[model samples]
Every structure is written in C-alpha cells, then in structure tokens.
Target chain A: MSDHAKVIKKHHDHHAHAIAKPGKRLMHHVPLAFVLKKVLGHGGRNVNTALNLTSYIDFLLVTVIFLLMSFSAGGEITVDKSITLPNAENVEDVIEAPMVAVNGQSVMVDGTPAGNTRAIRDAGKVQKVDELFELLKRKKELWSSFHPDKAFPGVAILQVDVDVEALVVKSVFQTAAFAGYPNISFMVRKRAKAGGGEGG
Target chain B: MGGVDVGGGGGGKRAVNAEINMIPFIDLLMVTIAFLLITAVWVTNSRMNANAQVPGPPNTEPTEVTTPEKILHLHIEEFEFKLVWQQGSTVVAEDKVPKQEQTDKEFVKFGDLAVKIAEQWQQHGGHQDPSDQKTDQCVVHADNKLPFRELVGVLDAIYDKKREQNQADGTIKNVPVFNMSFSIR
Candidate 1:
C-alpha cells in the first residue's frame, strides 16, 4: 500500500476506538471474570447507568425532616429497657435528674443495682431502704458540688415499672425524700392518641 | 445549561440555565442523614411530676405541731380510693370511689371520681389556702402493695379537673385544677 494510504488507515484505526484507550478495558483482570462474562451478554457494550437521584434525594429529605423534629439534644436520659414505664396522658416536660429505677423485683439507682424489692415487700410495712438512701444522698452531694452556683434543684426521677407495688414505690420514694431530693418526677411513656397525628 | 437543556453551555448562545453541581449537595445530605440516624433516639419518654412532698426525715427531735391549711388527699387502697379534703387538722370532706376490676374493659377505670371531687370541692369551698404550701398540696397516699398502674389511673381521673378562669380581656378560659403531690407515712 502507498505510504499516504497506510498513514490514513492507521489514523482511522486509532479514531475508531475513541471511546476507550488502547489497553484499558472494564472488567480487566476482575475477580470472577467468568461469572461476569456470563452475566453480561455478548453485546460488546460497556454498561453505563444513569443514576436517578430524584427519589433518593426525596427520601433523604423526608428522613432529615423526621430526625430534626424528633431530635433530643439533652442526652440527659436513656430509657431503661428492664422496666416498662406506665403510660399517662397528663404529662409535663421531662427534667434532667438522677433516675431511681424500681422494678417488680429490683431497685436500681442510675443503672446500678442497689436493693431487693421482694424482701422489702415481704417485710410488709412502711420502711426506709438503706442502700437506695445512701446512693441518693451521695448523688445529692455530687449534684451540690458540681453546680455550686445554682440551687440544688433537689429533683429525682422515679423510673418504676407499671406492675410494681405502691409499697415498693413508697420505700424507694421515702428513701429519695430522706436523701434530700424531694421533687420527684415519675417517668412515663406518652400515651398515644387515636384518630389523628398518626402519619402513615 | 445542564438540566433539561442538555447543551451544558457549550455553544455561542449564553446559557440561560445555571449548571448546579448536585454531587456535593448529595454528599452533604448523606452526611447529615448519617449523623442524624446515628444520634437519633426513638424512645418518646415523658414525665408525670410529683413535686416536693418529702415525708419528714427518718426520725427527728420532737417539734411543735405545725398547722396546715386546706389540701386534697387521695389514699389509694386495693379496691377503693379514699378522697379526703383536709384543713389544719380537720377533714372538710371525704368520699369513697370503689375501683372496678378489668372485665370486658381493656383497662381499669377509676369510675368517675371527678364528679365526687367536684361535689366535695363545691361544698367545702375548696381552693389552695396556702398556710403551709407543703401541707396545702394534694397528697396521694398509695398503699405499698397497690399496683402503680392503679395509682396512675387515679391520677388520670383527678387530673381532668378544670377550673373556669376569668381573663381581663372579657374572655373565659379553662385552667387545670390544683396540682397534685405525693406523700408517704
């Protein structure tokens, strides 16, 4: 062939493969090359997908709004999974306080096991719970020391189980009162209302 | 130039549409979602407060008996609730509402103690006459063995009390009744 024709043919060959470079190819030396080859039909075409982000962006927006609405910045409390808190309609805003959790069979102060509920109940009379009392007293002292400027807000949260006896509640409550934390907040679940506010 | 027009501002005509890079926007949104999802707390916890009714410390040196003013008291028993109104040392009024056990009903209702309490309040001219604020508050004496759920039910019944409020603007408003507290003997 003539030199001019040969040069033109070489340039055309290079231009024919303009979509890809000379050696680089997709799935080159890929793991499970046989499986990939079998999955992709012999069309000799590179799979190019146009990501439809509209729906994804919409999902993200809804999620973000939901999070924003339900966001709690206090980080002051966590739900005790051991006990099921009673549901109530008349509720006030939650306050940050040391929680004294009492269950059907146990008593815990700030997640630490303190006393037994069954023994106290078996005794069958009004009495003071010593372990709970001491823990609360120490908690009160700590609260007093840390925020010296503010008045010791003598507030305590009682995370008691719904099935627990009032006697157990009374003992723990009495102990807390004796500890000088008089203002008590009974932790409860917000009762769900019917006929509305349920966003399906 | 980028969206819909598809020209990407490559030609002589000035691009009417601004090409906004959505990659960064999506990246930012993803990060925000991750942060929120990681930190989101699902427990819708709430509180029912029993403010400052500390039954006196263990045992103390004998002191002078303090005169308390008018107050509402609900002593929760196993099968009944003793509703009493007291002033100083004397009880102004007292009533009983027997609790009903759950039969076909899903929950144990305290059986309309609101009407009884209202009647008692009207007859006694009930209000907070703050001689000693501590004593003037409504005290709930729930028995040790009584389940906490019943106590909550009693609270729910009484919490429905609404007092008619006369505003300066010539409008009437309804306000909640006396706030309740707890007491242990």
Candidate 2:
C-alpha cells in the first residue's frame, strides 16, 4: 500500500476504537491519579446521609414556648359538667380553695359527692346541709392541721348552676359559712366587655 | 468540572441523595399543633372569681347607741326588683323596676334604675364624706324562686361603675359609685 493511504486507514481505526468505548474517553478527561485518591480517601466506608433536623428542632422549641405562655399557671378550678356558671365582666382571678359545686340534682364538694339536692330540699326544711357541712368541716380541719400557725382563711369557692334556684344556693352558702367558711366566692365565666356581653 | 468520574459516563453525575425522610418531622409538628389547640380551648374556659362576705354573728355592741347610717337595699323578685333606702329603722325612699318583655330571650333592663340610684346617692351626700373614699354599700335580697342569673343582673346593675370618656384626650376614667352584697330572702 502507498504511504498516504496507510496513514489514513490507521487514523480511521483509532476513531472507531474511541467510539466503541465511551468510558475510556471519559477516563481520559479525568486524571486516573485523582480518581484513585478520592476512592482511597473515603476508606471504603459509605458516607452517612440524613435529614437536617435543625429546622424541626427550631419549630418544636417555638411551639413549646407558645404552649407555656398560654398555660394558666394559677391554680385552676375544675368545673363540673353539670353546672353552668353565670358570666360577669368585673371579676378577679380565683385563689386556690375548696370548690363546692351545686348542680341541678346533686351537690359535690371538692369532687366528692356530698348529697342529692332534691333529697335535701325535700327532707323537711333543710336550713343547712348535713353532708356538706361534714365534708367542709373535715376539709377545714385538714387544712388547719397543715397550717398550724395560720388561721383558716374560711375561703370557699361556690360553683352553682345558673338555672338552680336562689334558695338552694343560699342554703349551700349558709352551710359553708356554718362550717367555718364565711368568705365565699362564686366561680363565674368571664365576659370580654362590659354591658350586654356573652358568656366565655 | 475536573473531578474524578466515580461511575461510567452512561448518565450525568449520579443524582444526589437529596430525599429527606419527612415522616418523623411531620409527626412532631402534628403533635405540637394538636397540643396547642387543646390548651387554647382550656385557656378560654378559665374561671373568674366574684367574692361575697357572709354576714357573721354580731361580734361586739357599741356601749353608746347612736343613730345608724342609711343603707340601700335591693330586693330581687321573679318579675321585679325593689329598691329601698333606709336610715336606721325608717324607710326613706322606695321604688320598683319591672322586668322587660322579650319573646326571643330574657333581658333585664337596669339603665333607669342605675340613674335613680345615682340620684339617690347624690341626694344622700355620699360623695361629700371625705372619710368614705369607697362607694356606698348595698344589700341585695333575692327571692327564692328567682334564678341566679337574674340576681347577678341585679347586683351588676347596683355595682357597675360608670366610665367617663375625655374628649380632649382619648382616655377613659372609671367612676366607682357603689359596692354591693347579696342575701337570700
């Protein structure tokens, strides 16, 4: 073969070989020494990939702060489901004390069942409820024992249903007074504004 | 651009492992939101206290008896509220306020009654006594058949303070006029 023809044939063969193996062409683009260094630098261990938790933690912290601010730290009285309180615009925060709940058919003192309201009313003119008096007296004694130096504050909280008659409420009040609770407070739902307000 | 090729160039740089596990994060947020919602409801239902001092037994008697001070009494009935002003044992003035008629709901009207009480307070020289810094005291006697709401309305009427707004400066001031207590008749 002539010298020029042989040189062209050799060039074509090299081009065909390069096209057949694309990986070899890519390897030529990157240094083999650099690739070996990267592979060996990792020590053949898989790198850990995980979700970034910083944002989630920040959100949780914000929520916790909001909850703490909203929490009512003052001793909150648990109201019975049976009693519905009257709404008042001007009232103060309640202090910690024993609660006396007077519902439609029953009365409970500190969540303990005192007596049935209807039975007490029907039991021939009850000026003072015996069961409630006993319970309150017991509570007072217990409190007195705990605070030997201080006198009983005689403070009691009354949770009476708005639908209950005034007479029944009066009896409960008198009974609490006779049991050494002279300073009574009524638990009321707070109204937002002054006159013509709705219950909270 | 000159970095080592980790894999054969069949595809471009292998897609990065960008998938973030979201199950736990979503669960945490859901729980926090639920807790906040529950506490918000509870905060709205917090209780407010209204105090009443029960009349105790007579502790002591004055050695020298003098004329007793005048007292204002409020009598609450099912259909009406009666106002009685007394000095010692004599009744000085009396008035009655009837319930307003309503078909849809029960509403107690006390604006007129409040004006009358204010007038009586003025006539009695209640604001004149410097020693009496506090408002006049009122005793409320509610009927047995009366509902608690009605009684509260009567008390509120007697004890509600008036707010006077200053036009010159945007400020309001409370004019405390009465202090009240309740009793069952």
Candidate 3:
C-alpha cells in the first residue's frame, strides 16, 4: 500500500460502520475477500482487483526462508557473531556441553569471560589458563554431583574464530583437558557445498 | 477455474465462473515452505567431535600419553607443514608440504598433505589396507602466524572418508580420525 493509502486507512479505523455493509455480499460470494482483508489490510479495497500475486508470494517465501535459516539456530550453542568459525564437511550433531568461545581478544566460557587471550599471547609461553580451568572444574564438579551413578561426561565445545592464533587455541584446549574434560568438540560451520576444495 | 455467481443471480445472466482463485493456494504453499525452512535450522550445523587428548600443563600429574611410536606429529608454519611419523622408539618418516591457496587448480596444498598422511599411515604399521584402520590420532603443533582455518582444512582432509582410496579392492572406508589434538610449546 502507498503511504497516502496507509494514512487514509488509519483514519478509517471504523470501516465496518456503513460502507462495509455492501462488503458482506462480496464476502459471502468470495471467502478470499475476507482473507485478503485480514491479511493485506481492512476497508475492502476492491475485492476484484488483480494483483501480481507471484511477486508477493516470492517476497513472502524469501523472507520466510531467511528467517527460518537463522532463527533460534542451535539454541545450546549461540552462533557467535564475533567469531567466524571454519567451514567443515565432517561434523557430528551438537553436544550440549560447556562451550569456550575464543575470539581475537578474549576467551569466554559459556558466554562468560573466563580468560584474556591478549594476556596469554603476551606471556609468550604456554601457560595454564587458571581462570578457565577453575570455571571448567566447577562445572565438572557440578555435573558429577548431579549424576552420582554415572560418570561425568567431559564434553566441551571450542567455538574459536578461524583466524585465531594456534597458541591461544592450544591454551584453551589444555585448560579444558586438565579441568577433567576430555571429549572436546570443535564448533564449525557446515559448508554450503561439498566440493574438491581444501576441505577449505 | 470454476467460480460461483457474483451477485446470487439466477436470471440467465453470465456467472463469474471463468476466474481461477489461485491466490489462496499460493498463500498456503508459501506459508508451508516458510514453516519447514525455519524449523530445519535447529538440526543443521553441528559439532566436530574430536575425542582428543591435548598435551596438558606442567606440575600436574600427566595422563597416559599415546605410545611414542604411533604418534603422527604435524608442525604448522606460516607456509610449510612439517610432518613427522614416529613408530616405536624411532621416527619412522618425515615430510613437508607447502600451503596451497584455495584457488589452486587440480591440487590444493591440502590435497598433497592428505596424500602424504595416507602414505605415512600405510607405511607406519597400518593394516595391509590403510582403510582398515579408522583409529589414528594426529598431534598438531601450530605456529602463532598460522590461522585456524588452515589448520582445520588440513585436519578435515586428513580424516576425510575418501582419503582411503588407495585400497586394493576399491571399496570406500570410514574416516580415519580416532582423535585430533593440539600440542603446546
């Protein structure tokens, strides 16, 4: 609808008062008139009007597809906007576990800042990430308490940026490993197509 | 395209029977398509389970390490990947592969690395067919300059299911990644 039409329609909020009396006959003959009034807007703007339904449908379809693709994607693991994960073809289903996200500057454990990536880099040596290790250790202990009979499943997801340094990755991995988590999952974006690429 | 009379007329006037009401059908079809596409996102883009054993910190009691002989160590440099194969107390083999860009034709740099990894696996006490063994861990020591994308590309190629094509009978094999862990300084 044009902006002028929208403005006029807003003023005619009570379109059901008098002019819509004739619309009842149109509605009885064509149920689609009611549908169009509900979906498109009110005031019964020419029930017999021919519209380019193809383009309207195309627009709705495209909007729906984009919304569906990204809406609530992997609720357990939020697709971090800051980190660009590497694309990989061989991936398994996501396991619900403590996730450690390492971007360019900092390391966040389950969305909480656990350690400083810059500090680790400046250290110039492979040092234990004490903050991350303690968080993971607490998590492990909590899990063990919950399941007294079963062993604590030590699974963690490493959602690191593709451009992150290897030293930072290694530090996080070692911290998680030492904190009693052994089974690690690398969070990777599924490749759009399988081809003869670097697996790149 | 059957339609009903427009004004409830029965005096032999022309009925609105010539029009096909395709708008409602199109609306229904598009709504269904939109619904299915949105729900399927939850099931896609999962994790790569690397049941890996990373080399841990000092001053802590160490866990059981993989046998020295069976370790396949890959050291990543800016442009070179140094691969060392250690079997039993001695280093069995050593090789280096240059990094190739994604646009490299016929063979990218990772393709060569995948082939070398297979050859090493076959020679280093693998089954008569390299495809038979689906359990092998690779320890990668990467430099600070190397991007994680390059590392993962190599890792994906190493464990690719099709990497076992050098078999005699020509049957495809499962992936050959028992665990893939990174090493520290």
**After best superposition, candidate 1 residue B56: deviation in angstroms?**
9.0
Interface RMSD of each: 4.9, 6.7, 5.8
- DockQ of every candidate: 0.38, 0.22, 0.32
DockQ of candidate 3, scored on C-alphas against the true complex (2 decimals): 0.32
lDDT of 1 by residue, B90-170 (tens): 987788887664322223345456556656555654452322122125678876667887777666556545455565676
Candidate 3, residues A150-185, lDDT tens digits: the string is 977789999989878777877788888889887888
Each model's Cα RMSD: 12.4, 11.0, 16.3
For model 3, name the residue pairs that clash. Answer: A68-B38, B69-B88
Task: Provide backbone clash counts, one per model.
Answer: 2, 0, 2
TM-score each candidate: 0.68, 0.62, 0.64
Kindly give the stretch of ten consecutive residues in candidate 3 chain A with the minimal lDDT sum.
A191-200
Quote the lDDT for A101 in model 1.
90
Residue-level lDDT tens digits of model 3 in B80-112: 778887676587788888876563222122667
Worst 10 residues of 1 chain A by lDDT: A191-200
lDDT of 2 by residue, B1-185 (tens): 11233444435666544445567766777787787666563633333323345666686866677776667887766667688888877998887777542211333336555556666666662443433344566777876766776665555455454433243355544444555655644
Candidate 3, overall lDDT?
Answer: 0.70
